[model samples]
Target chain A: MTGLLAYFVFFATIATIYAIIVMGLNIQWGFTGLFNAGVVGFYAIGAYACAILTGPARDTLIGGFGMPFLVGLAGAALAAALAGLVVALITLRLSEEYLAIATFGIGLTVQLVALNAAGLTGGANGLYGLPRPFWSLFDSVQAFNLFYLVFVVVIGLLVWALLARLVRSPWGRLLRAIREDDVAARSLGKNPVSVRVQSFVIGSAIMGTAGALYTGYVGFISPIDFIPILTFQIWAMLIVGGSGSLLGGVIGSFVIWLIWTGSGTLLSRLAPPDLQAQSSAVQVVLIGLIIVLTILIRPRGLIGEKSAVSSKK
Target chain B: MIQAIADGLSTGAIIALGAMGVTLVMGILRFTNFAHAEYLTWGAYMALAVLSVTGLDAGQTGPFRFGLGLVLATVIAVVLTVALALAIDYLVFRRLRGRVNHITLVFASFGVALIVRYSIHLIFGGAAHYYSNDLQIAWLIGDGLRVMPDQALVFALALLVSVVLFLFLKYSALGLAMRGVAENPALAAINGVHFRKILFWTWAIGGGLAAVSGVFYGMTVQIRPDMGFQLLLPIFAAAILGGIGNVVGALFGGFIVALIEAIALLWIPAGYKIAVPFVVLLLVLWLCPRGLFKGSSGGSK
Candidate 1:
């Protein structure tokens, strides 16, 4: 019973981390109508930042400043936000498709650097032994996991509240206006470019925070963790949940993670040893099918845009 | 240096084929199909299945791996890929058209790409397959430069196909209709140009060409599920750098991008070669958003 409880707690914690990412994506894609295809890049930057800052100092590489956990988290958010600023400045002027491609490129570049830049990123082997907050305070693994779950839940709630408030504000209204029609928004004395940049940075910062939390939970960082597929997964989740709604982001993240983990477990149990490796291929195909089906059935997503209905009535 | 150029041109040939298809689709459909690369993968794998089924993997002909069986398989693969492309359009793209915006289509393409890529992986098991495993000694031309006969074949075929496609597009009535639709779909529709037929033909041609490129790419490099998807960036870079809808621009863009990649190996480590297209894309997008060509319409306007 305890084992099952612990597993649920662990699962919930990871799901919450993803929820954080989904919410961030919601802000950029949903609220601002910015199509960021390279989400994993910012997530990777955040993970690396936190891992480097909080982990013990290394001898051969540039990272391992050994800062506190909060500092690492802050660094992660700042680094991702900075990267977002750079991407937004360069690609925002172009149309949505170009911006998507450019961002995808940026993500790929970041992954390449992580894989190849041995001196800075520790290369493919990646950095390990990232310090988890308050790990030493707890006696048992279960206690520590429970503590972490509660801690992450608190942060998730805080982010959710903050984003919910932001999305309802006048700033959020302007973002939607810009998203719907940029020229009209511009004509109305609103600078869509600056506002988009702001939203991109903030959303990226949130993704970075999720990365930091992920690193803390996993206790390791690697280039393999930040593949383009990660971006696809997040997009799938957002699409499944509904793009423009914060509530959808939260619910969608948890539900998708549940499906992901649940199916993974089921696949492992069902498939024999020879076919087990191919199960991941099946999982991805299923996810892809889900995405296509969702687009077909409910392009607006499960929860959809709450603001539109509320404002219409 | 000569070897690098040779390699660049050969690779550029394959990229050009893929880019031309992509550019054509972008011109007519008016969206960057993220799943375009998957057609290449499907073509390669479909050929692989044929090769395996026929037990012709061992066949070699004329100082190259261009066996008769593989040749036949390539034809079959082209038809199969074109059918798949048309089916995808009928099922997904056709339904979504005019209902959703282009960005939604883009995302849908992403989903489709994932489905195709992983479906290939599920079947093919992620192992790289070669059309011919035999290694051919490169002929030393001069100045210690070596060139493969296979590479020569790739270059020639690419050139042949490009010219044929160019001529077909220029002279054929359907080609003119395609160009009209690309330029202005609504206007073309008003003028009684069959928009749906043009779209189907464009995708068919694009898919068929992609199949050839995929087979050539598999022959030169190796066919993995991720092969075409990995090359997507380079293909897009080629298309955009050449100018989105311009076939000639795509052809040149392919060569330029490939040449840049091959030569950039001199300065940066080979591990960073993947980022070269990205950097080139950023530079192109920044410096000349219209691409290197003028009057080649159908971009993010």
Candidate 2:
């Protein structure tokens, strides 16, 4: 029972973190018509930034700033937003494919910087033993699980409410318009580039916050942690849960995480001991299959975009 | 240095091979096929299988052990890659045709890339393997600057392939139809050019070239799933930097990216090797998206 609870807690922690990341991506791609394939870059920055600020000395490469957790999260968000702004300003003006190229390039540069600037990021070993909220008061594993769950749920609700408002407002309509017809929006005196950069910044900030929560929960941040695979996974979630939907974003995370955990557990039991070492990779491949099959069948996703009610409850 | 020049040329040759696939798909189909790297990875794995299948691992010698084995591997990789590309077109891309927007297609390609890469991992464990360098005996020159027989063979194949491709594209009827479709699909269709047929062929040719590049790349470095994936950024960088639709431009861009990647290793930390291609791509994209060559009208906005 305790093992099951811990596994649930662990998977829930990652799913909540991924929900925020996917929501951020939804804002950029689903709303603003920007294709940012380098979402992991911003996520990593947020994670490493907060990790460095709150980390201890000696073991810390760029850690030991000793800043409070929330403050570090804010700084991380701001940094990611700024990076998004810079990249958007440079490449958002380009067409569809060119934009993809630029964003992908930015992702590589971020990975390189994180890997090379070992003094700041602890290099490949990754930052470990991160301080979690209320970690001190909780002596048992179950207690810590409940504690982090509250923190994650609260943050998730706040993000959900805020994004819901943004999607419903006039800015949201403007975003839809831009996505539908860029030239037409430009003709109406709306600066598509400026709006895109704005959306990119805000979305990237959300991604950073997700990263902050990820670091605090997992208690580690490394260059390897924020690979392109994460970007692909987030995208898969967004697609599976119905892009441009608030409830979908949250629900998608839980569904994908459940499948990942359940399938992994089942496969480990079936496969030989030697092959079990590669189960994580097998899980990754399954995720890819899910994305492809899901996209091919239902491009809008499971929940999909809500339609008007006729005689519904 | 002559050594750097040789290294750059060989590196350029491989990139040129990879970039051809990227350029063809872009010119003909209109979205960057991000899964292009999977072809290279598949080739390397196929080569491994060939070596194991031929049972030449113990004490086999002679030109056939090295030469024929490599050739058979390339052929197998090419066949597999072409069929796979054709399948992707038939399955995902064809359905997406005339239905979705451009950004939708781009995201779809990403989905395909994710699927293909993970499938590779699933089929072949994510471990790195290498072909023995015993056959890679150096030929001539003062220092370790001499070309190995295998390296010379790869360069020769690249040169031959490009020449033949150019001739085909310039002289053949089907090639002309493909070029026409790229120029203006509506007009080409009015002229009775079969649009879908051209796209299928483009995927095949592109996949074959990608496999060739993969074999050469694996011969130089160890074969790992991420090897082809890591090269993707540079491959696209070469495509866009060379001018998206221009074959010759891709060749030059390939060499430029390879030279920069190799030379950057001299100064930067080894971990930053992946960043070199993007840096060059960014420079080219920022300064001259048109690049050094005159691009086909289809590539330009």
Candidate 3:
């Protein structure tokens, strides 16, 4: 029973971290119609930022500020936002496809750097011994897991409330207006580019925060953690939840994560031991099928956008 | 330096073939098909399956590493790949057409790519497979440069395929119709061109070319599920650098990108080679957004 509880806490913590990332995507893609495909890039930047600032000093890497967790979180958000700003400035004025390609490249580049730049990022092995917030305050593993879960939940809820409020604000409506018809929005004397830049930055910052939270929970960071698959997974979550809907995005995160973990377990149990390594590919295939099916059958997602501002063809 | 150039030329030819398909699809389909790269992987694997079934992959044909069986497999693979491409279009993309925006289509293509690539992974395992393990000595081609017979043949075949495609698009009735549709679909529809027929031929030609490229790549390199994805960015860079819809430009762009990557090995670590196309792509986008050969003949513009 205690094991089950611990597992639940662990699962919920990861799901909630993903929820935060989905929320960030919701703002950029769902609300603002900005297809920032490099979610993992920003997530990595945030994770590395937090890890470097709060981690103990090491000989092999550049960082080891030993700052407080909250300060590390702030640094992560700032660094990710800055990276987002640079990408946005370069690609936002171009076509959506250009943005998509550039962002994808950026994500790949980040991973490559984390793999090769040993002095800065500890190379492929990645950084370890990351300080979990208030980890020392707990005794047992279960107690720490429970504590971290609550801490993440509180942060997740805070982000959710803040985003919910922002979506209802006037700026959110402008984002939708631009999304539906940027020309019309432009004619209305609003700077669509600047608005998009703002949205992209904010979304990136949120993704970074999620990365920090992930680092905190996992207590480790590596290039392996920020693969293109994570970006696709987050996109899947947003698409399954309903892009423009905040609540839908969060719900989609949990639902998809559940499906992801459940599929892995089921595949392990069903597949022969010899083929266990290849079963992960099957899970990827399932995700792909889900994305295709959802786009075909439920373009608006499970909990679709509010009808008033729902995208009209 | 000479060896790198030789390798670059062969690799460039392969990329050009892939890029041509990408450009054609983008011209007619009006969205970047991310699954297009997977067509390369599928083509290679399909040929592999056929070769394995025939037990022909084990034997060598003359100076070349491949055999008569590979020739037969190539033809079959082209047909199979075309069918696969059309099937996917009918099943996934055809329904989404006109129902959603181009970005949605792009997203769907991503999903399709994942499915296709991973399906290969699930079936073939992650380990790399070779068509033939036969080793041939590289020919000394003056000034300490060496050229493999396989590379020479692959490059020659790639050029032949490209020239054939160019001529087809220039003179063939179907080719003209495809160009017409790509230029102005509504206008072409009004002018007696069947939209569906053009769309069908686009996939057929694109998939056929992709199959040839994939086979060439597998012959020279190794066949793996991730081969298509590893080459995805380079192919896209080629297509975009040549101008999105321009075939000739894509061909040239492929060579340029490949040569740069080959030469960049002198300055940058080989581990960072994957980033060369990305850097080139960003520069192209920044310097000339419409590509170097926009409004060229044989494309939409």
The backbone clash count of each candidate, in order, is: 0, 0, 0
lDDT of each: 0.88, 0.79, 0.88
Candidate 3, residues A212-278, lDDT tens digits: the string is 9988888899998998888889988999999999888989999999999999999999999999989
The DockQ values of the predictions, listed in order, are 0.79, 0.59, 0.62
Candidate 1 per-residue C-alpha lDDT over A1-313 given as tens digits, one digit per residue, 9 for 90 to 100: 3878988998899888888999889999988888888999999999998988888888988888888899998999999999999888887877778888888888989999999999888899998887899899999888888999999999899999999889889998999998888999999998998899899999999999999999888888899888887887888889889999888888888888888888999999999999988898888898888888898888878889865634441
Native contact fraction (fnat) of model 3: 0.68
- Higher lDDT: candidate 1 or 2? 1
- Per-prediction TM-score to the true structure, in the order listed: 0.97, 0.93, 0.96
- Candidate 3: tens digits of C-alpha lDDT, residues B1-301: 7788988988998999999999989887777888999999999999999978877754576777777888889889999999999999999999998887667888888889999999999999999998877797788888889888888887787677778887888899988888788888888899999988988999998999899899889888899999998888899899989988778888888898899999898789887888899899989888886789873433422
lDDT of 1 at A312: 41
Which pairs clash (backbone N, Cα, C closer than 3 Å) in model 3? none
Location of the lowest summed lDDT over 10 successive residues in candidate 3 chain B: B292-301
Candidate 1 off by > 4 Å: A307-313, B57-59
Best by the DockQ measure: 1
Between which residue pairs do clashes occur in model 2?
A: none
